[model samples]
Target: MIVVVEGISAAGKTTWCHQNAAQFLIKESYPEKRPDRQAGPGEAARIWTDWNAKRWSDAVAMERAQGVAVCDTDPLKLHFIWAMWQIGEVAESHWTAQLKFTRQALQDQRLGFADHYLFKKIDPDVAQAQKDHDAARSRPNFDLHLRLHASLVVWYETIEKVLSGRLNWELSETLPAAEHTPNPYRYDVSVFDRFIQMLPRPRR
Candidate 1:
């Protein structure tokens, strides 16, 4: 199974995935893309074009090996991030089409990317790091800022919908604080132990 573990940038997903590697083949949605790049002109489009191709190939190979792939991110969030950054309208037909393409690709590859939902959660440190990085950059483009905010909004909504509908598999965590409070490291010792206990039995 391709278990995709995603959350806001600093949501401890990396740590969680590493600890549970025996149960999953962890990966980020688009690992090849550079975060420091300026998001403007044709950069986003070009990146997506390359991303889709390589991602499809990588996914197919992983599935063929019957590997338990746990991706850190998925193309869904990447495109959503881009759409938020540049297009400004996720509901637009073109954006919808791109999202559908991603969905279809996952299905075609038989790489089941599990959407583990965590709602109303954003890692404060991660957000701050991004903001600081952007500010320090010699020429931070405006489009990137747009996408950053948009991606955050979309991330919250996307997780909320998944949780509400129970579309993906469920993994519970003991939130350190209320939804509004900042719980960057929400998955502490107790939550981590719970996650470990819930790991699926290995496939034959």
Candidate 2:
């Protein structure tokens, strides 16, 4: 089983994962520092494409060994791509390339769609308060983060719609199934593809 905890910055994603002590897979940190400046068009796409591919590989490997995995973020990097586009840090071609790669990863099962997604839904005021508390990390554009959070909420809803009966939807952190219940529906590439395509374009 693989579960993904998702939200905007300071939305308590990392904190929940830590508190649960699940096999937390985090992609934000790299052994080396990332390129500070935005890369030219396709370059940025290529970098993230490869980065997510590796993330998928690592997560799968862990699951194979441990039987369960919990991720701080999804390997699709949906929010990251949208946020970058909103900030004008990436071009359409870059987003296109990344989306293509994401589609391929889903199709190939290199990255399995998360069995469950836990979204930390909070009011805008609460989100702002959390952001302010985490002052050590620079969030120069709070509004952009808020918009990204809204976008992700919509995307997750679309995913649930596409998966419909197949997905076990749970808004809170509570487990969706009992210990004895069988999980009949597995990852469906077609449903996942539709979910990916349904993601809204970043507002300019």
Candidate 3:
């Protein structure tokens, strides 16, 4: 089962996936693992090329190996992210680079994940609770924060459409609630239990 935990930054997806899934495959999870480079690094392409290659490769290997792989984010989400950046007075070039990196990753099958759970209704109080739990965790990207919340209803609907049309997969924006605290990792066990209940069995 490929279970992807997707949401805005600092939405407790990483925490939730760790608790619920057998394996986790977020981008930062294996920062030391690098793949063979497909594109050359130069002045303009240095940062973008490296980021995409590593992310794409890691995704491919992890998905192939794990039974219950939990991806913290999906590159498809990049479209919204980059758009947010552009609308929030970010450098046009940077936003373009984000889209380019995501496009390359998707084309190479690195960003292709199945069984996504798109978290919705990221309450500010819930976000604050998570922030209090980790000092190193910075605030969500400002542009993304403003853009996603302002248009989440539309964004969520659009994502569902894309999932069906391009990936032939279903998408939902809800998950089992955390029993205590905002840690998503705590919810992984419940997710696995629910999966088991859905399986078929041999005749008695």
* Top-lDDT candidate index: 2
Clashes in model 1: which pairs? Answer: 25-68, 25-70, 26-70, 27-70, 27-71, 27-72, 29-73, 85-147
> Number of clashing pairs, model 1?
8
Instruction: Give the whole-model CA lDDT for all candidates, comma-separated.
Output: 0.42, 0.64, 0.46
User: Best-fitting candidate, measured by TM-score?
Assistant: 2
lDDT of 1 by residue, 1-204 (tens): 334445444445555666655344436545455532333423444456457546545644664575444455553344343435344443334443444444444445422223233322444556456546654443234345334544554544544443343223322342112223222322243432343234322222
Evaluate model 2: give its lDDT.
0.64
TM-score of 1: 0.45
Error of 3 at 160 (Å): 0.5
Error of 2 at 186 (Å): 6.6
Lowest-sum lDDT 10-residue window in model 3: 178-187
Candidate 3, residue 165: lDDT:
28
Tens digits of per-residue lDDT, candidate 2, 1-204, equal 666677777777776777673544544444265543245645655566667767767766766786656677777675577556655666667667666766676666665666666777777888788888887878676677776766666766776776554343333554434232222333466666666677766666
